[model samples]
Target: MRTQVAIIGSGPSGLLLGQLLTNAGIENIVLDRVDRNYILGRIRAGVLEQGTVGLLDEAKAGKRMHAEGIVHEGTSLAFNGTHHRIDLKELTGGKTVTIYGQTEVTHDLMDRRSETGGATIYNAKNVQPHGYEGDRPYITYEMEGIEHRIDCDFIVGCDGYHGPSRASVPENAIKTYEKIYPFGWLGVLADVPPVSDELIYANHERGFALCSMRSHTRSRYYIQCPSSDKAEEWSDDGFWDELRRRLPKEQAESLITGASIEKSIAPLRSFVAEPMRFGRLFLAGDAAHIVPPTGAKGLNLAASDVHYLFEGLREFYGEGSSAGIDDYSRRALARVWKAVRFSWSMTMLLHRFPENGEFGQKIQEAELDYLVHSRAASAALAENYVGLPF
Candidate 1:
């Protein structure tokens, strides 16, 4: 098979990229090692930046999102036994974030792609990109013990951190930077009304806790835990009790408890691989970088990468110029590093570090105090939260 572009991984990044390319009349094929149901089964955070919403709209996958997603004008920061709201819209000139689950986003994009008859090969085994360094690039995979090959003008690796896309790059040709946090997030999803209308990010003497929701009736909550903690160890009642202990007096008093529908523990880490493009092969989303979920930047960063990649491909095809593709790595990395910094800062500010001792605790308190009171600091947070210009 021959195509203009061959996409590795069918996650949101690859699916979104495929949709955009299809809309542009570009022929591309998506290859994934897993089936669609497996992809949908993976639970992820929702919080969509305004720019992400626009991309979904451009891909014709925002209908369900705009209809069902809740719009939050601001989010709250809790510390010192009280809540302080940061008006994201006011701070970012009418910008706001949409509370939608990443699962829903993927579902919408998948449906849109299916309706348009886009080519996506699921359960493709041993998928590999070859000859990316030269003018001719192609992908090889196996289906039901039958080998297949796809010749393409370019290859895009949206296959994520552990996928073959990044593994294919020679170690000497790529440099990676990573930091693993001392704690992980023990999260629960329950069908209960949220304690607050907007999300609350709390800093307590014990640890950090976040109050988020998938919808008005489905709440998603998380609390910092030891790096070795396991989800099965915590009971539903225990999780709720601990969460309440971390919040302010009023929110804790009104907080509703229920049986958890889903539970998991996710470790926090920040990782980035430099030079996203290698010859005719390019990396996007988790294939290139990862951020702790503290600032809710994971999915948003992936969308941004897709935005840059799509624009580059579009320019190359529409104008017959290689400038955009040539500059893709530099442009994507600039915004990526900013987000990595923001996520890292937020993680350091909220999480409890026993090793840092009392001095670290005091510094965090002072920074949070200044952030909530100072307009400039609040504006900066709001700007990054709503997302920077694409």
Candidate 2:
């Protein structure tokens, strides 16, 4: 079989790209190693930058998001036993973020794709891209004990960090940078009302804790712990008690607790692979970069990547210009690096580092104090939080 473009992975990035391409009269096929149910089962961050929301609208997948997603004008930062609010909308000239889960985003895109009858092959094993260096590129995969191949004009890898796309690249052709934090986030998803109207990020003597919500009745909370920690080690009561200890008195008193629907520990890391384009095979999303999730930039970064890639592909097919494709790496990386910096900065400012000792803790608190009190600093945070322009 053959197509104009062959896409790997069925995550939000791949589905969003496929939807955009289908709407543009471009033919593309999506392949994933897992089925749709497993893809949607993965729980991820939910904060949507205005730019991301616009992309969803562009893809015609924003209706349910606009209807069910909560729009937050600002987020709160709690430190030194006090709570401070950063006016994201006011600081960013009316730009705001939407609180829609990533799972919901993927579901919407999948539905849109199915409605349009786009091609997506799931549970294909050993998928690999070949002959991307020259004009011709194709993909090979195994399905149901049969071998198959697809010939396409280009290949896109949205299959995530461990997928075959990045792994297929020669070691010398790519350079990677990574920083693994000493701690990880132990998170819980509960069907309980949020303690605050907006998300709260707390920097306390104990650790860093985040209070986020998917909706009015569903709360997602995280507390920093050692990198070696496991989810089963902490009970619901223990998690709640530790979270309350990290917040201010007012929020702690108002906080509600319940049985957790999901619980896990995610290690914090900042990683990026240089030159997202490898000949005709371009990398997007987790296949190219990763952030600590402190500033909630993971999904937003992927959306920006798809935006750049879609525009490039559109130009190639619509105008017959190679400029966009040629510049995809440079363009995507420029924005990727900025987000990496913002996420790294937020991680440094909010999380407690035991290795840094008392001096580091004091410095972190001092920076947080200055960040909240200074309008310029606060605006900078708000701008990054709402997302940089695409």
Candidate 3:
């Protein structure tokens, strides 16, 4: 097979990139190791930055999102038994975030691809990219007990952290930085009305808890737990009990409890691989970096990476220029590092560190206190929350 670009992985990044390129009259094919249903089954963060929404619109996949996604002008931060609201729109000059599940975004993109007859080969086995450094790059994969090869101009690795894309890079050529938090988030999805119209992030003596929702009637909640904790360790009632204790009395009182529809524990980490580009092969999304979910930057960062890569490719194909492609790594990393910093700061400000002890706790309290009282600090938070400019 021959194509202009060969994308590995069918997650949001790969699918979104494919859709965007295809809509622009570019020929591309997506290869994934898993089937379509398995890809859609994974539950992920829902908060959408305005930049991400625009990318989906460019891909013609924003119809369902704009119709069903909830818009939040601001988010609330709770500490010291009080909740303070940060005005996202006011601080960011009319910018706001959309509360739409990542699953729905994937579904929309998948449907659009299907309608347009885009090429996506699912259950592709042993996918590997070869000769990415040369003028011609190609991918090989196994399917239905047969090996196949695809010749392409470029290869994009949207295959995520564990996928073959990053693994294909020589170890010495990449420099990596990572920090694993001492705690993990135990999250639950329930079919009950959210306690608050807007998302609430609480920093209490117990731990950090977040009150988020998929929609008006569906709530997604999370509480910090030990890194070793497992989902089965807590019952529905127990999870609710811990979560309520972490919030202000009023918000807790208004909370509605129900059996959890989905529950899992996700460890927090901040990671980045330097130089996202390796010759003709480029890494996007989870294949390149990971941020703690504290600031809701995971999916947003991926969208930004896609934005950069898409623009670079579009420029190369449209204008016969290599400037954008040549500068892709430096530009993408600049934004990626900022987000990494923001997420790390948020995690430090809100989470309890057993290692930090009394002194650390006092510092966190003082910082949060200043953040609410000072307009400058609040504005900074709001700006990062709404997302930095693409």
Candidate 4:
């Protein structure tokens, strides 16, 4: 059990980091509590920023993704019985987003790993590392209740928010930045065809409604609600009817089918932890930070972190520049803050508060209207949604 690096959590960030490190000719071991994270058909997000496409391409995993992924040049903002289309691709010079689910991305990476198999362990539990200064840093874990140990040089934390990796770092050193939004998103995956060619983000008197898709036959959507709302209580008919009410009146009512196959709720939020690195330990993906899903920044930000770390690690391995690793946290924070700000901005503009009175509602609606018509405002959104150049 000896390797150059030890990666925790095999989710998007962890997997992508493994791929990046592999390209850098650095050997690493991936540890996961789950034995296998196949396509459970979980619905997280379906949008990608313009710049994220390039990063995926460099990984060589973009080959199959580009073929299966749907590209959307524009999205709609429906209000006052009209739909406003934002030409994201046109504004960014063919720089559009792909409507691919997060689950699919994970599956693609897992498949790619088989072709480039390296040190990895599934269902590995009780993983512990000691002696960061030594060449053979010991990593001990349980594989099917059997204790095991492997030595590695450095540890990388990609295990996400709740994993033990964060706790392993010194408590006082981590500065956690977080905000709990007033609302949650009731995400539903349906058997119905898509309601539109592109995503439709609507702000209604009732709540915010999102119309997006999974594939040719599958449809995905979100309805804003209180943090306490539960999907199990929401019947299929009730969900469809409410979606219709929130959707734009002009859109064909026939677009939705009779039933939704699944429904789930996710609390909206914006969070970030400072100093992503601690000695030989480093944080990536949900292990490092989280953002509200409004701007579809979570996965992209994770992708960016791995890319930055991969470059820094390459410098450290090839040029023996520890400076690159030392500055990893600062460099990653620049992009992380950008995503946090965008996600918060989108959440505030779309969701309503219980304290909002009639005048407040009027002001909010006015802002939405302005965002629809104003080129400058739309450009601002375009820049954020497609991602700032990293």
Candidate 5:
């Protein structure tokens, strides 16, 4: 198939790019290694930044989001058994993050794209980007073991952490930077009501816990855990007991009432690659960088990348100029790096590390204390949390 842009993966970045290009009257095809049923099959981030809300709104992806997404006033931070509320709207000039699950976002995008006159191929296998710098560089994939090809002007890689996009970039074409943490987040989704009024980030000597909601009936949260254990080994009772230990004792909060437990182990890591573009292929989203989810910047950063990249492509095509295209890599990296730092900071600060020296723990506590008491320090957290306006 021939297209102006060929997008890999159906995650937020790929879909958004397809939508944006479609709106711009640029033809594009989105290829994925999995079907729609498999694409929306996992549990993921639910929180959307205030700026994310605006961007989706402008792109018309916000109507369903605003209607279905749970809007929170702000989030809470707990330490020493006391909670400090950060009024997000007050701090960020009335910006609010939404508690809409990523699954919902994908479903909404899929429904819209179905009527959008765009290509969404699934179960695509053996996908390869070859013959760059040509009028018809293409991606090869197989569905049901039948090889197929997608011819295009450029290929956009939005594949997640473990996809083929990263490997496709030739050696020395990109510089890989990464930091892996000592701990990982154990996340869960329950049908029970949320334990608090807003999302709460707790700093416990035992570990860290996040109290967030998916809807009126579904609550989501996370706990810091050792990186070795798998969720399958954690029984239902074990999950609840772990929750009780992390949560404050005063509240009789328990996960029950037909709440099916789904757990995921999240490794805290920060990574970035120099020059997201390689010839006719451009890497965006996890194919480009990954931040720990503590800052809730993962999905938003991916969306931001596609936004800038889409604009650059449009400018290039319209003006027959390569300036915007040339600058796409640098411009995308600036916002992505900021988000990486934010995620890394949030992850390191809130979660306890066994390997942390006594002095390091003390230093961490001191910083947390300053964050709660100092307005300047708190505002910095608030801005990064609520997200920077792009």
Candidate 6:
């Protein structure tokens, strides 16, 4: 098979990119190692930066999102037994974030692709990109016990951190930076009303906890735990009790407890791979970088990466220009690094570091105090939270 672009992975990045390319009259096919159901089963972060929402609109997948997604003008930060609100819209000139599940985004993209009759091959095993260093690169994969090859002009690796896309790059050609936090987030999805109208991020002596919601009745909550902790070890009552202890008394009192629909522990980490472009093969989303979920930058960063790659490809195909494609890595990395910094800073400011001792805790307290008291600090937090410029 021959196409203009061969995309790997069927996650939001790959689907979004495929949709954009198809809309531009660019022929592309997506290949994923897993089936459609498996892809949508994974739960992920849901906060949407305005830039991400615009991209979804461009992809023609925004109908349900705009209808169901909750708009948050601001977020509350709870520390020292007080809840402080940061006005994201006011601080960022009318900018706000949308609370929509990532699963829903994937479903919408899948529906759009199916309606448009786009090509997406699932259960494609052992997928590999070859000859990307020179022109005429192609992808190879195994399906139903048969090997197949796809000749394409370019290859996009949205296959994520462990996927073949990044593994295809020569080890020496890439530089990696990573930091694993000492703690992980024990998250729960429950069918109960959220405690607050807006998301609440609490920094307490116990740990860090966040109160987020997918809708008015579907709530998602997380509390920091040791990296060694497991979700099964905590019962629903225990999780709720611990979570309440981490928040202010008033916010905790208003909280409603229920049986959890989903529960898991996710380790926190910050990682980035340099030079997202490897000849004709380019990496986007988790394939190139990962940020701690503190500032909710994971999906937003992926959207920005997709935006940069799409622009480059669009310019190349539409204007017969290679400038955008050639500059993709530099531009994407510039924004990626900023998000990495912001997520890292937020993680440091909110989470209690057991190893950091009393001195570190005091420093965190001072930082949070200054952040709520100083307009400049508050605005900076709001800007990063709503998302930095695309």
Off by over 4 Å in 2: none
Q: How accurate locally is residue 377 in candidate 1, as Cα lDDT from 0 to 100?
A: 100
Q: Candidate 3: list runs displaced more than 4 Å.
A: none
Error of 6 at 42 (Å): 1.2
Per-residue lDDT of model 4, residues 135-208, tens digit only? 45566788777898877767888888888778776678888988988888888888878889888888777888
User: Ten-residue segment with the worst summed lDDT in candidate 6?
Assistant: 381-390
When superposed on Cα atoms, how far off is each prediction in RMSD?
Answer: 0.6, 0.6, 0.7, 1.8, 1.8, 0.7
TM-score of each: 0.99, 0.99, 0.99, 0.95, 0.95, 0.99
Mind giving the per-residue lDDT tens digits that candidate 2 earns over 45-137?
899999999999999999999999999999999999999999999999999999999999999999999999999999999999999989899
Best by lDDT: 1
lDDT of all predictions, in order shown?
A: 0.96, 0.96, 0.94, 0.80, 0.81, 0.95
The sequence of per-residue lDDT tens digits that candidate 6 reaches over residues 299-386 is 9999999999999999999999999999999999999999999999999999999888888988999999999999999999998889
Candidate 2: global Cα-lDDT?
A: 0.96
- In the predicted model 6, the residue pairs found to clash are none
Residue-level lDDT of model 1, residues 1-390, one tens digit each, is 999999999989999999999999999999999999999999999999999999999999999999999999999999989999999999989999999999999999999999999999999999999999999999999999999999999999999999998899999999999999989999999999999999999998899999999999999999999989889999999999999999999999999999999999999999999999999999999999999999999999999999998999999999999998999999999999999999999999999999989889899989999999999999999999999898
With a 3 Å backbone cut-off (N, CA, C), the pairs that clash in candidate 3 are none
How accurate locally is residue 349 in candidate 1, as Cα lDDT from 0 to 100?
Answer: 97
